[model samples]
Target chain A: MENGYKLSYLDNLESESIHVMREVFAEFEKPVLLYSIGKDSSVLLRLAQKAFYPGKIPFPLMHIDTSYKFVEMIDFRDKIPAKENVNLIVHKNDKYIKKRMHPSKFGMDKCCKFLKTKSLLDGLSSGGFDAALGGARREEERSRAKERIFSFRDQFGAWDPKNQRPELWSIYNARINPNESVRIFPLSNWTELDIWHYIKKENIEIVPLYFAKKRKIIRRDGLILLADQFNSPKEGEEVEEAMVRFRTLGCSPCSGAVESEADTLDKIIEEVMIAMNSERENRAIDYETDGSMEEKKKQGYF
Target chain B: MHKEKDLLRLVTAGSIDDGKSTLIGRLLYESKGIYKDQLTSIEDIAKKKGEKEIDLSLLVDGLKSEREQGITIDVAYRYFSTQKRKFIIADSPGHVQYTRNMVTAASTADLAVIIIDARKGVLEQTKRHSFIATLLDIPHILVLVNKMDLVGYSEDVYEKIKEDYLQFASRLPTHDIQIKPISALRGDMVVKKGNNMNWYDGRTFLHYLESVNIVSDRNLIDFRFPVQTVIRPNLDFRGYAGRIESGVIKVGDDIAVLPSGKKSRIKSIETYDRKLDKAFTPQSVVLTLENHIDISRGDMLIRQRNVPEIRDELEAEVCWMAEEPMEEGGEYLIKHTTNTVPVILKELRYKIDINTLHREEKKELGLNDIGRVIIKAQKPIFFDPYVRNHKTGSFIIIDELTNATVGAGIIWYPSATLPETENSQ
Candidate 1:
């Protein structure tokens, strides 16, 4: 992996991603990137920056805030606009909270739909954004493993994995009708290893939860669950002390941490490099149903 | 250090249950691409399934349902690298119903590795896959006759399948179709040359994969750069962003911008930090032009003498992928390179039969059907022929109502070639 001439796996991935981002700008009338305050989204932002170097990103950044994210992620998000000097739009499910929305009341899928998908869709409808670039990778799950670089969505933002537009060569179909927004995945071909390698190579900043930490946690369903506001354990579940770190980040209720001592990004990268289970394994919502993830995608879950 | 390994984009096709997933799994496993934890999890799953041996299929069958069903239901991509080449294999399903998946995977593939069962010599599915490989114009084709142990490693059987394939492939426009006999289950003549096929003289699967000629597969003649976006920094810098579609671009070369018909000289080509002296296909770079023009997206840059045609009407051979047949009045979003323009089907030409390579007169095309049609676009687009240059010639048709990509099209006659006649029209 000499840093010259050669297109390393990461380099090719970046090139492909940048190319896709440019296509989004070229083909769509209005495009925005869904930036979850995570490393993958950060890399996507950096790639977007590179794709339009010497100019600001043409589209604004959209973040579907669950209102239960880590404080560190929020703090970092606050400073990013000033650092990058780009437009950022934060969409929160304020209506859901006003309606006394809780995951326990309607289950994980409905909660995700309201908090994440509905918020994002509400933002898009208001802003008239036609395309939303995401940082989803196929290696995350089985149904996702068959995704194309440019994935089409219906007017309601539903995805039918069975029938997708065929993407051939460099030609990407980014066209969408009125009220229909396409979700462009720039990192569709990238794997977790590729993301880590790029993060290390580029020295990208990420949330602190990714590193090792000693926190009050509970072990249930063969997972070391992080103790967050929404995940305080049911009456029957037990709480325990565990030195755990998150492999992925989301709403604290659904996102779980694995027991590990690796605190630094390098150590975390090494652990993830050799870890056998998929990244989404620790996600509580995916396993709630047979194809809950796919079902959510059908209803416009990013 | 030895020259950095080149990228090899390959696609695998075979009949369902012909061990396509197993072969891909073995290749990735043997190449050290699968992490240790992934291997362990697969082993655990294989054990739970009560298999006598650890099933290699578990390595790639990522879907839990696909695992329970004991079949690959979708196209899964797996990447691995050796000292010589970095391989991206599209592990597509082999069932006849999933033929669309195989075609989608093979469209961008530089080569197609068609796996066949030695016990079943030259099945109908094999011909279908091979015909697709030819139609897609994959430069290299490697036919792997697997399950040789079942056939007792008989050299005559290998030759028969090879001969049958060669005879069928001869009818199609294919180049460099090589035959190899191996057992995907036994791992014979796959990653390594085995002793079972003593009389076989061809290189092993991995050896051939690493050594196959792909540099010639790219079109290096016409210089095409479709401007993706324009970059004008408030920080007092100017650059035009685009990925090189084909050929090479260098500093101080005369270039022409399409649609607007403006000419300028390339002042510099920049990546992230530094300026590049020269750039070629697939490299996304920002170019600073000698003169500032009203250039935006949907514009192309090329050498003035070797420019693509700017035309409004197009004759294209299209692969209709949507369940609903293509109609004359329906509008689609036609995407070529970085440009997306709405187009309407002007006339139905003829559909080509994949099995017999014959043209059938049809008013509409169904799913997985390839046909020639005339289309009219709202705006004139610059393009080349599908055979001459893939980057500029290829386009996708997205259904306006469903927002689904319904067809993949290749320009048969570009408007750029008939610029004078098109201008008068």
Candidate 2:
């Protein structure tokens, strides 16, 4: 759309994200895309494909699997590498996983730190990546509001809350020390509803579990958990099949499902428009304590 | 007049107690952007603390340090949308020390809402933010004479402040300036017109934001497409990829590559998905040339006749953010477009005395210092004057030793002298 024809909001967001990804490609070497295989990550991947259209993504797409994710997410992740020419690398903290690390055994924060933060750090350093492209959006949390488009990390990959570089216009300063890595957020400006609208517009395929489906679920701590090989009912805890869909996808142990019959894209968008709660409310890790996300971010949590 | 409204990036710059955060919080609240649980939690916390007001500022200042310090340290962003448009608000810190933060937020803003408390009319902070917003070439500015309730909702106070601001703003380079009185705390003249302001007539802030003419704001001429990367996914196709900075290009158009001065014809315009009849400004697209010309990331493809200025050295007004002062002969990396080349601070022509709005001789610039300097680059770069097209004209200076972004500079073409490259000394 040009001249008098207005470009849609989603188009603007897509262009902005593509520009960010292009900067990473042009400015830095050894940059990696932190793929979470969620809707946001899928959108990020599609944008990367667009940024390097007709060309394979120059860098690898790394996923730090906690091994507690929904099976559909894993299946989707596995199917992507074969269909696309993208360099996909799946890394896990083998040492920690061998210990059978669970949110039940440790806490949500502790498990996430080890399985996600520590594993991601190990994976990134091992790959020698100088910058990482993530899918975090500013509208997700209050603490996330202070994030820069190109967030700088110290030698320890810790995000300093107070001393952040001033990012101006499209001219992103991608320079960082060799020991430091920049966490680049391409979707920092997008809202949750915008993501849903984009997903509908682009017809971007996501995990089928996002749509309402009948599955065995157990309610505990005000959250609906998928009763599967990874998650099961406790003694005297009731397990029942319920119609539900995930507002967000994370480790099965901590992620929660919301009650909805919004199976189609239009239905999901409609639901999101009228939904009264923030999407992060369904995220159990955020409710661990006050300032949990910020605390985690300071300690290098993505 | 367009069928759809695009994204609107706005920045709210105000002094302390101007209720900028409350204004943003009210906008989000009115737009149904805030969640039920989030509001309840804030309310619960407020009650527990025995607070009278909800402290809407807490919603905007999210950083732990920011909350602890009771001030915003960096540019905090919030997104809210109406049916017409989506908005991203960069709530900049209000303190005078955060000029860099305000400038950083204003760079990419299509519009800036300069909040002024009605009680304190035209203060130092207002002038500073207004000057910074204008200097950065933000197209539209809406001066919200906020907290009118504190001034008894008097039209006289609003008129007086508006007149004072207009007189001050006349000295600066501003495209469009509109001033209105608002009580952000009481939900007056924000999303809807308040009942108290019976004498005043103007579009509410949200209505103006939703219906503002933004499509015409973009530069649709002088095509400047900096090649970001060479897209060679496979052996079959090879395309040059970048987001179009300005103008429009279609298939079979003749173009020239800058720096290399290579000529080529656009065989097709690929938008990463499908080939299009034409592409306009700001669309990220890939293009294949008729011939295999040597093009890299730093190269730009422009219309043969309509091209940006190519220069090796230029004048610029820089905002230094580094803790250390700028050196006269310092070598730093100048990143313009997709090009990054070594540049030297050849001369410190003069620094702007922000308080007086006058150019004063300064040997060096420290943190939060804005000064005009002469930068000599290792090679020529294709750029435009920051006044013409900000996307192609602005750049950042990186410290070679620290790899930190030391300063932000706008490409300047001095009026009194010839181009810096043609000068002998």
Candidate 3:
């Protein structure tokens, strides 16, 4: 994608991301890229490969699995590490899983705490990772729009939005104690459309679930949820089939797919251009309450 | 896809009451960046707050304290785009204590729009922001004379404000200044030409933002590439990975590694997906050399004859960032490009007053204090004068104990060295 004479827009984005990766590598000792096996996560993985060039990504990538991700995504995650030659680690809250804790039983908010956020907290604490690169982009959500590239977290892994340090220019303040972890967003400035464009241009492989397919979906709590183990039809509820694709990926229960026929990258780009709804609109967690994303961010949710 | 290189990074500077947030809200609304669902959410929030008008203060100010207090506390980055260009605004607070945040937001901005109330004319905060924008070397400045409605859309008020701001800006080192009249509340001359400001024939603020020519500001003659990491994906290739801070590099051309001064010929230019024939400023690439001499991070690659100043000691204008006042002989970590060196602040020359532009003798600099200080790095670090290049010239000082970034330094002058290149702009 790089042209010697003129830098393509994608090239510019890639260079900026690579610079961020190098900064994280230079600054922190135990840094991990939080791989969710989504399109954005795929872009980050490849960027890390290109960032270090001959050297492998110095730190391992960890996925705080809630054990409720799409089957295709889990398969891709398991198979791609060897091909890419990047170290990958997966951690799930086995305690919560063993206790049969479900979002339906313990409320969606509390369920997320035990399944995703608490598991991530446990992973970082055990791994001793001082810094973790998140795949969050500013254009996704409102609270994300205000985030710094190198976002600072306190000793308890809590984000103080008001007390965040000022990041001037490319100079990031990675200065923190050993116990305090820094959440870095190398893709902070990238938009959702930018991610799709880079994916198609680089020919990077992502899960085929992003493309439109006929899936059994049910309407629950004003959300289109996939009919999976975590989300089955309630009594008297009907399961509907439709050609849908996920704009943003997460656990199957919370992630909603849009009714899109965009089976290819070009079609998706065209569909996204004319669409009025943002990708963040598809996430179930963001709609729990007003400023829910900000509320979750304060409690150390990515 | 239309490969348009029209991304504009800008900063908005003004006091809290000058409708800074309102102007940003207008820009977002006008650009259609605020989607239908988001607008609905904002309306819902506004209704809950019992606000008759849409309060944009909720949009930019995400922190609970800021929203309750109705003031911005930290720098928040907001992104919006027009058909022509993508815009990222580092929206920093205008509080005096948060001057450090202003400097941070303005550091990487190509342009700055410092709003001044048309009714109040140019104030002290206006002058302070203008000075900081100038000191940061922002290529473009727009003295946004907002609230034209309050002045009855008079031609004289706009003219007087422009004259006063220009007179104040004259003392500072800022050029390429543009002024526009607008009313963020009534929406005059923000995105389109409002009927009220018939006297103002110039482009709207958004139009000006889309068309500002920043191409000529970058140094393209002298090539400077600071190596960040070496890319040796396998034994078959040895690529010097780095972002080209300035100028162009081509294949088969002779280049020299800085500090070591080792000369080699370019074998190939490696990019992520393919090989590049040539590369220019700000494009990160992996370059392979013919000889494959020892090259790693912290070493720079430039055109054979043209090189930057290599000095162990430098005098710079540093904006103190930490709460602790800068100690004269304290050892700190200095990060410039891909290099980090232990350095000591030898002396504090003086501090500059943004209000008066006076050189006041100061013992130490605390938070948000702008001062000139002499620093001695443990080893020779390569740099350019801040006036010429920002990437090669700028650096940050880190407190060793706290590991906090204590100061931001811009090299004012390099030590006595040979001016080898006559192609200086």
Candidate 4:
């Protein structure tokens, strides 16, 4: 494509999204971006940078950390915010963690509710934020497919799919009553290819685990799981060496890696192109339950 | 260089079962848009799912339930660009239940690619898709009769289906509609021109999409720029922020800010670091007015020669997206451009029969229904016809109670009650 005249598909999508993000800044009283150290979030961050060029991102960046993420992700998170000079607020489930709550007790979905959603809500409440920008895409899940670009949340932080606001044109109503907030998804229109193309075009840095690496793995729930020290294997569960990489990143307990030899960006993208299954197919937690994502989203997981 | 200024946005309508996902997957794949690892993961899934060939559908069927149930539930957007033009493609689900998603995708599209099962020529859902595309006023439409290889590359079959579609689409409001015999599964008439269809002289799907003349689609003479926000960085500089809704504005040209009717000259347009000598339709910039005016967010900057209609009452074509039908005399918040005002539905003119292009005079319209309504706003909105400028003509109805968007509307006329005083004189 002629770079100047004809916009690459990624370029046009980026233009529209940047327009939406600027609208978010113009309409909302207080808006913050929920920054998870992942590909989608990285793209969102870059879009924000482009949106307000010459001016720093008008909003702050918040991360609802479960404290079980890869250490490298957190390090990158901290360093980028400083490098960009974006306001950073690191939030964790301090109270729940202090109580020594385990994922085994309440299950993966509920654990996400307590440690992720609750912490995010807490941050919103204290900061008096009326709207928060998220990096979630409809292609991520079924329930998410029904999500709006400017999704409304009730006073109790519940998403009534049946009661979703109609989003038409580019005109977004960012109005919310007390205790209620909105989740603005600028990347709602971007696809996996768009994301990868954008990453390649912009040379956006992502965590190393996304690239294939030889790591200790365990066979659990018929999937190869990344062997984390925190989640020790139960009796008779054998651990072995496997070349694995993660499609998505989250708490170590639920997120699983697929065995692959594709280490470079080109190789990983080629792998994605030929793959015929959903990205979440390999995640152990998803296979064990149904509507797990919907339940978590209802509780306000970003 | 002249053609590059114009671009087309398209949406594809179908379900996972109909191979809509595979069609898009293959389109991206053949265009060299897919990455290596993504392809690797797709291969692994194909093996796990026990498919004979790599299931390209899995690449776009990203929803959890959709994947498990083998269906597509929502609008999944996919983007790919060619040398001649860029495209923002929205792949919407085919099910009747997710019709709202279809409406959302169709609202902004300049063209629609309606995919059909070759075995089931012109089904009920096919009509529904075409109907919505017409209602949205999409300038161009393409019917892809997919899975043709299943029918042994039968030219007779393709012709029968195309004729059936043309007969049905005769009543549609669309201007330019084309039909192509394609097998999204076998790569026929998609990225590469099909060799089997020697009788068909038209360009392949990708070629037609890239070459279609879109420069004349937009109304460039009517100037409309709805100011989003005011940007004042230093003591000496004062700027009005917005994307050009229609027409163009150049430095030193005189312009009028709407509602206020304050006139000012454009000093310069600044986009981040660069100072632009000229700005046109769709370019977002901060315009430095020659003099400090009373313009703020929601104010419009337009050429005095082509002023838009300013009125309190609006007659519009609305696509009802909510399960709750719009009630007569019901009030809601309407956000058009940067302006948000409370609006009441004065009357339900008539509901549209999407399939037949018939008008159903009804008191109520339900979910995924299209209707024309007369509305009275608490405040007047300035605008042009949707054909003149989509940016200023389009709006959304937000539920005052829930803040959910219940309807999407494009203005038709101001109202009958409002006295037509000639402002042009």
- The native-contact fractions of the candidates, in order shown, are 0.50, 0.81, 0.46, 0.24
**Which should have the higher lDDT, number 1 or number 2?**
2
lDDT of each: 0.79, 0.86, 0.83, 0.76
Q: Which of 1 and 3 is ahead in TM-score?
A: 3
lDDT for each residue of candidate 2 in B194-301, tens digit (9 for 90 to 100): 799998989988888987788877888888999988887677788988889888888989999998898999999988668888888788888899999888888999
Which order, best to worst by TM-score?
Answer: 2, 3, 1, 4
Q: B1-425, model 3: which lDDT tens digit per residue? A: 43365567899999868888899988877776667777777788788889888887677876666666777777777877767777778887888465798888889899989999888999988988998888888888998998899989999989999899888888776478999999999999888787998877899888888788766777787798887777665888787777888888889999999889999999988865677788787777788999969988789998888888888999999999888899998889988888888999999999988788899998988889999999988999998888788888899888878777788988877546535452232
Q: What is the lDDT of residue B73 in candidate 3?
A: 73
Q: For candidate 4, lDDT tens digit of each residue in A75-135? A: 7887986787888898887999887666777777667777888888888888888888998
> Tens-digit lDDT track for model 1 on B1-425?
11245778899998867777778878877876665555666667667769767777666665656667877666777777777877788877787445577778887788899989888888888888887777677788899999898999999999888898888887876477888898887889988777898898788899998888777667666899888777877646678888887888889999998888899999999887577898877788999889888887778889989978778998988888888889876788887777778898888788888777788988888888888889999999888876668788788888777667788887886534544432111
DockQ of candidates 1 onward, in order?
0.35, 0.71, 0.51, 0.22
Best by TM-score: 2
Query: Which should have the higher lDDT, number 1 or number 4?
Result: 1
Ranking by DockQ: 2, 3, 1, 4
Higher-lDDT candidate of 2 and 3? 2
Error of 1 at A9 (Å): 3.2
Better of 1 and 2 by TM-score: 2
lDDT of 3 by residue, A1-302 (tens): 22235555567778889988987887788899999999999999999988886568888999888988888889899997788988899999999989987777887788898888888988998999999998998877777777889888877678877666666667666778769889999999887777887888888999988899899899876678888777889898889998988888888888888898999999998887677888767787887887777887888888
Q: What lDDT is reached at residue B54 by model 1? A: 77
On residues A1-302, what C-alpha lDDT tens digit does candidate 2 reach at each position? Answer: 44554577778788889989988888787899999999999999888888887777889999999989899999999998877778899999999999999999998889999999999999999999999999999889988888888999987789987777778878888887677899999999988888887787778999998999888899998999999888889998889999999989999989889989999988998898888999988898887776789999999998
**CAPRI verdict on model 1?**
acceptable
